[model samples]
Target: MTNNKTSEVPVQDPGADAVSESVIQLIRQHYTLDARRIRRIYAGLGSRNWVVYTPQETYFVKEFISSEDAQKGKRSIEVATHCITSGIASPSTVANRAGEHLTLLEDGGLALFSYVHSDEQIDKFSIDMMAAAGVNLADTHRALSRYTAPGEDETDEWLDMDVAEIVETVDEILGEISKLDQTSEFDEVSRRLLQDRKVQLANYSRLIEPIRILTRGVIHGDYGQKNLIVDDTQCLWVIDFGSADIFLPAYELGRAAFPPENFDHDDWLDRGLSMIKSYALRGALTRQNLVFCARAWLVQLLQSVYGVKQHYLKPHELQEDLDLFWLRRGKATATLFESLEEVEASIERIL
Candidate 1:
């Protein structure tokens, strides 16, 4: 939710001319509006997003980068439709003149949707807002409970990671870290954290057994403040279903609770529990689920570290700042993990 500005800014890509021409062509051919202006929206890690403004109405367009991702985009729209019919606040898809939800691009796919105007000030979310978000999340889960994907069979694989898979991932990350030259500060810190994560995973290996049996369903893959939008009428609309997949419900809850922006908040724990309690009122959230929440927090921390490691391996111009950022995040995550026991106890009382 950073760097979100809605102005008449040009697209960042150097090939903006060609891209805009193609998009304009799509709009003119498929829709009934004179495209007035278009500006890129800097949100989400996946997909190139743009806000297309017309004299009649505005639209949000997404251009997928891969065929598999395009398929997911199609599935996401279907999921959103189900959620909408179930009374969840989500965006409505804007199909082309051909009556198709997706426009197949050469490399991937494209889709247009009704633009949702929202406040991007996630850091300013009030306690009531947090609680509301929790309730909506539960509502989303309940609505998705009855969702059966088209052509879905036993052979369809969902994007879920079990404890065993997480453990294997830990080993792989550690091995990758060890192979790096330990000269730079980033390398040194990454190696140290990776080693510690290996130990932590070993200690908490037993917790995985209970987590595997928790409530599983279609969850908003990246549910957090970033994906939420407060519409003109103050209704919160959840967007960006690109990562939607079948997974433990607790994963979504935990992701919402441990967003990096909330790390420094004084009453984050209280607010997080309040959201959890609100969610429980609409859906099932047991003490066992709270345990998995703690585990989820740890996993998020490890994932952050792994992300930093990946950045270190890649060639980027902001290498200096990236290392500093990783160090700071590493320290914060380590500090949180140290106090996780106390955090878990407090969350337990709420249950």
Candidate 2:
């Protein structure tokens, strides 16, 4: 649940267009591909993306804005390739004419992927897809567990946090949001949520419990709505094996199954546990592996303020972005903090 790396590129991201003459030439020459049409799509931060159509088929293209992102994208491509070979339901990477995942560019880089079509949103929380999501995530973890990326020994996903420092950061952002003019809707909502979170942070310490037994491995970095597409048959297609190097099952399960939208549902806990239990059954995991989940997620929610910084502090850097996502996440964090005791008790009883 960590924030993305800070990119040092220009504010004018190359997210506008990829169908220019020179770019088309690079795509055709290196990958021997012709684009019938290219439409820009938002995949994630740090990339210019397009859902493209060719005379033959459809595909997705991602172009990174910086060298650092390009390199991480390459590694993720490697991991996705491995996932496909291991029988995971991920899109296959298309190599350029030179037989590499990336077609390197002057300022950034581009990569192509087979297209995935979906008829549903995970927001609907369809009964069939929830269980499928669990199995999909479990299978992904099982496959990545055996894979160690190039020049890597071991990876740990446990968050390193100081309670006081996080509280202070929260306080700082809250105070900053307080001084806003409140003319905009985001400013109004953010101010109220910050005030609520400040009160909740006082008791957040009660949720803390120390742990020693830890398990860590490669993780599917982003398993949320953006990457998970439910096709017409309702099979969960996991995509975009992000630059995630390490993860803990407890944190990720809470992150994936207990989405922000689920908090509003009356049976949120049941749905979350259903997904987690399904994952555990498919992956053959034990109770101890998931025991610390409540604490793991609690700490993460406490640390979340990426939205605050993006909205209130660095507004200039903002583009056509996921504004609703940040607000939903902030609201969910408040709900969880208010219900910490029930959340922890439920996880303990079930797991």
Candidate 3:
């Protein structure tokens, strides 16, 4: 289902002309720069990114998908600023003439930032790179330790899944699966995966309580090789705080070590231990933290299985292609879940 096409210039979307005009006007009015070219970058989820080339310099423009994300975008900028001040390599937000980080757009919000010339090659990440990623994340955590949100009552969209919420979600998914015809392989796999996850949730329900007592902080919600950018100078820069949230450090560490998608490497256990060691040098990681890490990994797999099931249930133009995609993902999740005990044991030994 993935496209393998590579082009120097991105193909224009249907509204490219109108969007280009609006971008130009926004830039001229606010930043006082004339845009020469604007090309869309379709990499991340939920946001429309465009790389704008102006006569002065190149910049990155991010357009939020919803109005609510406008506030989140602003907060991300604030957190990134704090990270940069704490000596972490992060992109700096470019304020407008009015000294505002966010610009109101017709549908949502737009923010401009200095374009970072970095490469995000997740498949090419070596153990050394993983260790470096771990160290970078630790530094980020240390920098963000003192951060206090401007609004005390603000809700984070990237909250960790709790036992009650997970149970409720599984119940809803089971109900939806029961209504399905189950004629296709995708449907069968969905039902099986959901059933397996429900059992896993019940078995691991006790770990969630102790996780609540662990050290908490603001963390990069979507920490992974893809979100990490290795610049031309080989300095690693963390990007995309769209999913930033305040949660137990163990959850972040676990999510970072065990991403939803499987990688090409087979030595994940070693790489994960290296990351944990590097992070432990800067922060704390108790045995309970490792337990929470395993639980977090299971939670992410459950979410992935649910997401793929939902996609399969919904009628899509590329349902035929997506059938294979979801099937492979389901199989991978099942395989990982079956051998999760080994991974957890390894983490425990390291701790």
Candidate 4:
């Protein structure tokens, strides 16, 4: 479940005793900093890691769950760097130490990164911009498919596992979460998500299995505009490879199918068509494969349900996402799954 921890506004420059001091120190020392200022910006997926602001730059510092697991995460980032340099866009890694991606601070963990443009969500993203992202993402996947994981890759952790484990874990947290006096609605929402998840478990697994095995490569487990930056020149700079992996093509393609806004029905088929066209520019698009891709999109939607269930999202949030999710799906269903297929055909005919 999501950390319902009371919001503690982070100090502009918290001291060494703050949350991850040892790791931060190691990172600074690795950078050979004479000592200036280090500020904690936000907590990342891993509690031990953070988005840090140094005097002259920004970085992602990750403290290992333990030194034993250190190499696994470190190697993942190292491989991710290869993926980025190979053509995928990712936050550049400027340094590495102790087999990890960043300096190993005395406190714990490691650090790595180069400064990136600020993450301010655009009010409106042009179709051209999204098309560019689709193309970029496809090129990245194709490049990564050529390589295999390092000996210590952590990308395999979530593979071949049933959805039951995640559901059980989320269900176990519900009672404890409800004990907190936040609001009744959140608890209610959590409960319903749990129930919906119980029914959807088998369906999720079946849908995921085919694509998971078909498009196995270094997959970006997470892909969204939040981790992407479009500069003044419209060059898309992708960041945050913390969840890159070897997984399904459907996963990545489904993610690219949606535009930045809350999912909608109107023009989605056209949107999907454009997105796929961008991805398959020099490649062939088969009718059979695109149908599988449509199913993959549905699987991705259900995966969100799994996430909401596990994260204990508020009922209102779940409702909002569900509405958008179905809206997008509704369009695909209406088009008889030919939106993307038609786009491919149009391109083929043109060629």
Candidate 5:
């Protein structure tokens, strides 16, 4: 946890040259790859990612962060492989030079992921898709039951949201704001949120309940649409365990609701419930725990409110930060919150 602001990611360089080259070589060694003809495809805007293209096969290449940041990425790949091996629609790791899913390149860390051929349309997030996601996620959790975090020496729980970390993130964001040279626009509410974070940090303890470890398993810490690759066949190919972890179900559920600002609110809520019900259908979710899952959304929203306030929306993105979270204002914390409340209430009614 460096003091670098929330604006400055711990792993700043996404595509290190050495890592990228190593990844290309590794893929060529292990898979059917056209080393000279490989071209980079733009799959995601955030990460320094490249899609390797060949006549017969296509795969993904990514330069990860430094050693410290690469651990999570490595854990995510391991977790996904476990799920695939256990029959989940998960992509397997192709070749990791460091034996761990990551290898240190001259510029930074690098890893290769199986590129899924996806043509699945972004349908209006429906109950069916949600439920499928949930059931699949439960299966993911079940599969991860045997896996553990890759690095043995690291003691910090990746799933646990530490107060110190929150404070650190806040401080880092503010520092970045100071560096931005344009403070007048963000001066008003952002300042208030920064000052109030001290209170939020204090109140974080009051919000704790007995953590529901519904099942002990590896979690795709960032389990949502952006991370999943759905093929034309409608098969869900889970990828990017960069934010993956070995932790409780509650942690995974909470993280699911905190998507970037541009994501659809209705889709977020509906899919959330679908995931819960799917887990329930698989006997992974119990009635009482479902109520807890609902509460988990609230807790997640609360934390996200803090995070959204701290982190700057993508410069190129259209929606304003507060507008995205307008629902979670005086009465609304996030646009997604009310729908979540309804979902939770629905669960309670059934109970």
Candidate 6:
């Protein structure tokens, strides 16, 4: 969901040099910052981030990439605020002097936040951290429940999508790849992966024909390792509510608990178990939630092909390595999808 399209705003610098003059003016006017330091930072999934320094405090600035629907931006910040008010340990979006969460740019939006200090970059988390993340997500789900509930039409938005149409999309992607110059091995691997995509996508549909009805709600859509940060005290601060949408909580839980990178890890099962037990401590997860996560997860991995499309077709918009990152994750997920029943039963054991 985060790896979708690109949006154009009136900005030039893409690196650590300096923010555009218009953005600087916006900062000065909206934020009332004098002569402090500002520098761009490396953040992905379609948003640009910066760290602003001042005499009293440090602040984090984020540039919303898409402005086509400004209401979406409003809803995202509202969700983030709701998450914080519900006692979730997340970075809070600070309102401007005029009491607005979002300051729309010429074609995009700008938001200022209280900077979260994180001294460590967690590559892999321990079981305790896993459980903590699970509990945090549960708390977040419960928090969002107060703001709004997802509508009935949105329940099948993910589940009822036609696999055949997705296969056709894959074919179009393949045809585009075939026309490329084929510079390196990544190009070759992409071609092979798309071939896998067409067949397995149909097979996946047949195997899980009647996708189970899932627990539906508006959630922190991209709740993965990338969006999670660890501070000096080892507390996990969930960030990035821009991709917030209607989704199955268990589907998201399954992806986080049994991610493809850790699917074959020796303690993968135990780690997932810890997460589930922690989440279910307050009975946030249902029996249907437990049973359908794997199937939904498989569908997500196969069908969420925007990252691949952006990387291959729209080359300059994303990093070159993103193709490999997504392709590898997709392949691993397909391998795990073959054992979907085992995964379902294993996770259901905690139920």
Query: Per-residue lDDT tens digits of candidate 6, residues 38-145?
Result: 656655655677666667887777776778534566767777877888898888777776888888766778888878787454544567878888888788888867
TM-score on alpha carbons, each prediction: 0.80, 0.85, 0.80, 0.64, 0.66, 0.85
Model 6 alpha-carbon miss at residue 344, Å:
1.7
Encode model 2's per-residue lDDT on 1-351: one tens digit a residue. Answer: 011332222213465343443445566778877765555664478776766566898877787888888987888888888888888877788889999888777777999888877764344465455667778888888888777663332232233446567667767777786676655777778778777767766765555444235466667777765677767666667777865566566667778777887776887777777777677778545676665665566667766767566665575244335466678778778777777568767766765
Which digits, one per residue and each the tens of the lDDT, describe model 5 over residues 1-351?
A: 011111211112455355445555656655444643334443332345666555666556665535654555655666667667778776665564335555655545556666777664555245666666666777776666556543231113432567686677667666666676667644545555555655645655554453444433456666776666667777776766544444456556544533443244535555565566667777755666666665554455455444354245334232343433432331333343435547668656544
Those runs of model 3 whose alpha carbons end farther than 4 Å from true positions after fitting are 1-17, 120-124, 150-188, 207-210, 242-244, 303-306, 312-336
Cα deviation of 103, candidate 3, in Å = 1.2
CA error at residue 180 for candidate 1, angstroms:
9.5
After TM-score superposition, the amount by which residue 137's alpha carbon in candidate 1 deviates from its true location, in angstroms, is 0.6
Pairs clashing in candidate 6?
Answer: none
What tens digits encode model 3's per-residue C-alpha lDDT throughout 1-351? Answer: 012321124224544467556766677788766766776665544566778787789888887877877767877888788778889897788888788888876677889988888644444256677778778888887776767663231123333456567667666766876787645665666678777777766755453445556666667767776677787677888777643466666777876765544333577667777777677666555667755575665555655543454464465544554555566556555655676678777767766
lDDT string, candidate 4, 171-214, tens digits: 66566566777756545655565555556555666555655544
Instruction: Please list the residue runs of candidate 2 whose C-alpha ends up more than 4 Å from where it truly belongs after superposition.
Output: 1-23, 121-124, 150-158, 181-183, 203-206, 316-322, 348-351
Worst 10 residues of 2 by lDDT: 1-10
Q: What are the lDDT figures for the candidates, one per model?
A: 0.68, 0.68, 0.66, 0.53, 0.54, 0.70
